[model samples]
Target: MRWRARVKQLLLVGIGTAIGFNGVAVAVAPGRMQTAYGIDDPTPDLTVLLRHRAVMLALIGAVVVVSAWRPPLRPTARVVAAVSMTSFVLFAFGTGVNAAQQRVAIADMVLLVALATATALPDEPRPAARP
Candidate 1:
């Protein structure tokens, strides 16, 4: 059980770090992100929207990281992570998966699985045995 909890903590932190890094990249270079995501041409409006999305992603990642230390917030963080990853996966498929999109979708799928596993495990530590 201790190991399981540690694994969950690691996964959550890893996911959070990955997501936060992506968000930072996107925020810093929306045009580059657009190209990387397979968008050939992006308008100013699209760039603005992408920046907003980047902010949201960063916020979510931050929450997930913070929740690692707060048991009560873990459930909410899990739900947010699951929803965000699942939605990205669906959107990637819906839009048609290019090589880059496929890679991102795969990562999102892995994160989804990790979040699910963490959520399924017990958050509280095991009770101590009476001597």
Candidate 2:
């Protein structure tokens, strides 16, 4: 049981790191859009939107990472991560993604599985209630 909980925490942290890094990359280099999503010659308006999105992802990733060590935050963090990944996967498929986007969708699918696994394992036991 202890081992299982440790594994779950590790998985959550790893997943969070991946997500956070991706956001950081985009935030630092908006040009990553060209390689990551195959967007060519994005307008200034699009760049603004992309940067905003990067910030959102960063926030979500931070929550997931922090939740690993803060049991109280796990549920909300899990829900947020799920919604973010699921929406991207559904949207990419529903609208027909290019190769680059398809790769991202695939990665999200894998992350979803990892998320499910982490969710399945029990976290730390709560303290006993006061009399």
Candidate 3:
């Protein structure tokens, strides 16, 4: 594979893993919201919603990671990742994020740039078919 294609794949893998791990952690321990987002005392209803969001994040991350190796899935994965990151960034800004949330927003912005660069890069060349 060409250097650009390799770089793109690597970016997808790294970012996907980071996102997935975070989701899993939060899913396993919903209390993380208190520390991560400064939620002092979340109601039971809030906990359920947060856990659901964590699952969605994990699914999004899985799609992104799979797309790294499956070119055919790239378009959908890109859309998923873009929407996930864009929504969080917009919501954070719109609602006035706390310090921890601000950090997450910044990281999401950086990841968005990386995702854009990967998308802009040339795709890998396919092998010639046999006669």
Candidate 4:
């Protein structure tokens, strides 16, 4: 309804859809890390990296959820969202998913963009004034 409400929604969805879902997918989905980039890892580095990414994203998700619930930290939330977005963008670039098979990467990119969009909402204001 309101712009502030919309911004909150954006943050939650971006975090849940992006970090929460993606983190779980990366952590437990069989061969997700390896298959995400279509690579053949001889030492399971991707798996370890994927797990690490999952933990980082889980923490990020907690931050997002907390910010969404409280609304007083919207600016910091926005900053976190932006950083999260950047991380996935970097992943997209680093993984080098082909143009044709970049759907997952693109989905992540969408989440980041959504976060950026919420951050840009004029109604959101500074974090202290939000709640």
| Residue 105 CA displacement from its true place in model 2, Å | 0.7
Off by over 4 Å in 1: 34-36, 126-131
The TM-scores, one per candidate, come to 0.85, 0.93, 0.94, 0.65
Better of 1 and 2 by lDDT: 2
Better of 2 and 4 by TM-score: 2
Find the 10 residues in a row with the least total lDDT in model 1: 31-40
- The TM-score that candidate 1 achieves is 0.85
Please provide, for model 4 over 22-61, each residue's C-alpha lDDT reduced to its tens digit, 9 standing for 90 to 100: 5776667736655554545525775686678777776677
**Which of the two, 1 or 3, has more TM-score?**
3
lDDT (10s digit) by residue, model 2, range 58-126? 888999999999988999999999999999999999999789989989998999999999999988676
Candidate 3 error regions (>4 Å)? none
Question: Which pairs, if any, clash in model 2?
Answer: none
In candidate 1, list every pair of residues with a backbone clash. Answer: none
Strongest candidate by lDDT = 2
Candidate order by TM-score, highest to lowest?
3, 2, 1, 4
- Candidate closest to the true structure, highest TM-score: 3
> Model 3's lDDT to the true fold?
0.86
lDDT of 4 at 59: 69
Residue-level lDDT tens digits of model 3 in 1-131 = 58887898999997787677778777899879877667768899988888888888888899899999999988998898989999999999999979988888888899899889889987888989999
